[model samples]
Target: MSTKNKRGWIFLFALPCVILFCIVYAIPFIMVMATSFCNYTLTQSPTFLGLDNFKTIFADPDFRVSIINTLKWVVIQSTLHVLMGFIMALILRRKPKGWKFARVAYVIPNIIPTAATAVMYSLLLNPTFGVVKMLYEKLGIDTMQVVNLFGNSKYAFWTVTATWVFYSGFNMLIFLGEMGAISPEIYEAAQVDGATAGQADRYITIPMMKNAFGTCVILASVAMVSQFDIIYMTTRGGPGNSTLNLPMYLYKIITLENNYGKANAVGVIQIILGLVLVILIQRLFNQKKEIEEV
Candidate 1:
C-alpha cells in the first residue's frame, strides 16, 4: 500500500479506540472537573462556587477521618497484603506437597464476587449464630462482654480491614508468573556458589522480582483507596464513620446529601491521589532499578 493509504488505514483502525476513550473516560473526567468548582445538586442547577466545596470538605471532620482511614488501608494493603502474596508465591514456586490443590484453593476467594465475599464474612462474624460468636461461647467468654466487632466503632475499621486484607490471591498469581519467568540457570548458579535457598531468594529471586512486587503494591494500594463494596455491605460506614473511606464518603455526599459539586470534588481528589500514588510507585521502582544497574 502507498504511504498515504497506510496512514489512512492506521487512523481508521485507531479512530474507534479514541472515540471510546473519550466517551468512557475523557468526557466524564472533564465534566467532573468542571462541576467540582460549582455548587451542583440533584435538585438545583450548577452555580459556580470557586473553592468553597473544597474548603468545606477539608474542614469537615468526617472528611479528615476518611482520609486517615483510606491512607491506613493503602499502607496496609501495599505492604502486608503484597508481602503475603509474595511469600505465597515463593512457597508455591518450590512446588511442595499438594501445591496444585493449594494454588487452586488460594485463587478461589479471588474469583468470588466481592458482594458475596462480604456477605460470607458478615455471616461468619455475626454476633448471633455466627462461628466467631460460637467460638467465644466455647472459650467460656461472657456473652455480655463480647463486643460486636462490626458494630463497635473501636473494632469496625479493623473488622472491615480483615475482610479483604489477606485475600491476596490475585497478587500471588502475578508474583508466581513473574517468578516462573526467571531463568532456572540463575538458581543453579547460586547453588554452585554455596548460597543457601534463603540467600538465593534474598539476592536473586527477590531482586529479580522487584518489578512484579512494585506492580502488585501499586495495584493493591490503589484498590484499597477506592474500596467501597465490602465496607458498604458490612458496615455502611457505621456505627459511626469509622469504616468510611473516600469512595464511601463521596457516595454518601451524592446519594444522601444530593451534593454533586461536593461529590465531584471528592472524586477529583481521589483521582489525583490515585495518580500521585501510581507515579510515586513507578518512580521508586525505577530509581531502584537504576541504582542496581549502576
Candidate 2:
C-alpha cells in the first residue's frame, strides 16, 4: 500500500479508541463540570447555581471530616500498601519454595468482590463470636466495651483500614513483575562484592525498584480516594462520619439527598485531586530517576 493509504488505515484504526474515549470519559467529565453549578433535582429542572454546590460541600461538617479521613487513608495506603507489597516482592523474587502458590494467594483479595470482602471482614470482626473478637478475648483485652468495631467511633476508621490494608497482593504482584525484569547480573555483582542479603536488599533491590514503588504509591493513594465499598458495606460513614471518604460522601449526596450538583462538585474535586497526585507522584519518581542516572 502507498504511504498515504497506510496513514489512512492507521487513522481509521485509531478513530474507534478516540471516539470511545470521548463518549465514555471526556463527555461525562464535561457534563459533570457543567452540572456541578446547577440546582437540578428529581423534582426540578437544572438552573445555574454558580458554585453553590462547591460552597455547600466545603461548609458541610461531614464533608470536612470526610476530607480528613480520606487524607489519612491515602497516606496509609500509599506507604503501608507499597511497603508490604515491596517486601513480599523481595521474598518472592528469590523464587523460594511455594513462590508460585504464594503469588496466587497474594492476589486473592483483589479478585474477590469488594462487597463480599467487606461482609467477610465484618463477620470476622464482629464483637460476638467473631474470630477477631474471640482472639482479643483470649488476649485478655476488654472487648465488652468496644464490641462492635464498625459501630464504635474510636475503632471504626482503623478497623475499616485494617480490613483492606494488609492485602497488598496486587502491589506485590506488580513489584514481582518489576523484580523479574531486573537483570540477574546486577545481583551477581553485589554477591561478588560480598554484600550480605540485607545489604543487597537495601542498596540494589530497593533502589532499582523505585519505579515500581512509585507506581504503587500513586495507585494506592488514588485507590483510597475512591474507597467506598468497605466503608459503605460496614460503616456507611456511620459513628458520626468517622470513616466517610469523598466517594461515599458523594454517594450520599446523590442517593440520599438527591443533590446531584454537590455530588458532581465532589466528583470534580476528586478528579482534580487524583490528577494532581498522579502528576506529583510521576514528577517525584522522575526526579529520583534523574538523580540515580546522575
Candidate 3:
C-alpha cells in the first residue's frame, strides 16, 4: 500500500477507540459537569441553578468532614505504604531463603476483592468475637466492650486505615521491581568506598528510584481520594461519619439523600483536587531533580 493509504487505514482503525472513549468517558464527564450547575434529583427535570450545588456542598459540615478524612487517608496511608514498601523491597532484595514465597504471600491480599478483604478484616476486628480482640486480651491490653467497629467514633477511622496498610503489596511490588533494576555495579562501587548497607540504600537506591517513587506516590494519592467500595462494605461512612472519605460522602448524598446535584458537585471537587495533587507532585519531583542536577 502507498504511504498515504496506509496512514488513512491506521487512522480508520484508531477511530473506533477514540469514539468509544468520547462516548464512555468524555460524555459522562461533561454530563456530570453540566449537572453540577443544576438542581436535579435525577427523578425530576433539572433546573439550572448555577453554582447553588457547589455553594451548598461547600457550606455542608459533612462535606468538610469528608474532605478532612480524605486528606488524612491520602497523607497518612500513602506515606506509610510507601515507607513500608521501600523497607520491604530492601529486605527482599537480598534474595533470602523463602523470599519468593513471601513475595507471593504479600501480593495475595491485593488479589482478593476489596469487599471480601473488608469483610474479613471486619470480622477480625470485631470487639468481642474477633481474633484481634482475643489476642489483645491475651497480651493484657484493654479491649472495648462494644463490638461495632463501624459504630465507634474513636476507633472507626484508624481501624479502616489499618485494614489497607497490610494490603499494600502492590506498592511493595512496584518498589521491589524498581530496586531490582538498579545496577549491581553501583552497589559494588559503594561497598568499595566502605559504605554501610544502610548508607548505600539511603544515598544510592533511594535517589536512583525517584521516578518510581513519584509514580507510586501519585497512584497512592489518587487511590486514597477515590477509595469507596471497601469503606462502603465495611463502615458505610459511619461511626458518626468519622471514616467518611469524600467518595463515600458523595455516595451518601446521592443515594440516601437523592441529592444528585450535590453529588455531582462533590465529584467536580474531587476531580479538581486530584488534578491539583498530580500537578503538585510532578512539580515537586521536577524541582528535586533540578536541584540534584545542579
Top candidate by lDDT: 1
The runs of at least 3 residues in candidate 1 whose Cα sits more than 4 Å from the true structure, single-residue gaps closed, are 287-294
Ranked by lDDT from best down, the candidates are 1, 2, 3
Task: Write one digit per residue (lDDT tens) for candidate 3, span 72-95.
Answer: 988986688877777778888888
Q: Candidate 3 has what TM-score?
A: 0.91
Indicate the residue-level lDDT of 102 in model 2: 91
| Selected candidate, larger lDDT, 1 vs 3 | 1
lDDT of each: 0.92, 0.88, 0.86
Q: Against the true structure, candidate 2 has what lDDT?
A: 0.88
lDDT of 2 by residue, 1-294 (tens): 999999999999999999999999999999999989999788887889998989988999999988899989999999987899888888888889999999899889889988999999888878787887788778898877537888899889898999889999989988888888888898899999999989988998788887888889999989998888889999999888988899999999989999777788999999998888888888888945666689
TM-score of 1: 0.95
- Across 1-294, the per-residue lDDT of candidate 1 in tens digits comes to 899999999999999999999999999999999999999987899999999999999999999999999999999999999999999999999999999999999888888999998999899888887788788889999766667889999999998889888889999999999999999999999899999999999999999988898899899989988899999999988878999899999999998899999999999999999999988998888945666798
Give the poorly placed runs of model 3, Cα more than 4 Å off: 132-147, 287-294
Estimate the TM-score of every prediction: 0.95, 0.92, 0.91
Q: How many steric clashes does model 1 contain? A: 0
Which regions of candidate 2 deviate over 4 angstroms?
A: 132-146, 287-294
Alpha carbon deviation, residue 145, candidate 2 (Å): 4.8
Clashes of each: 0, 0, 0
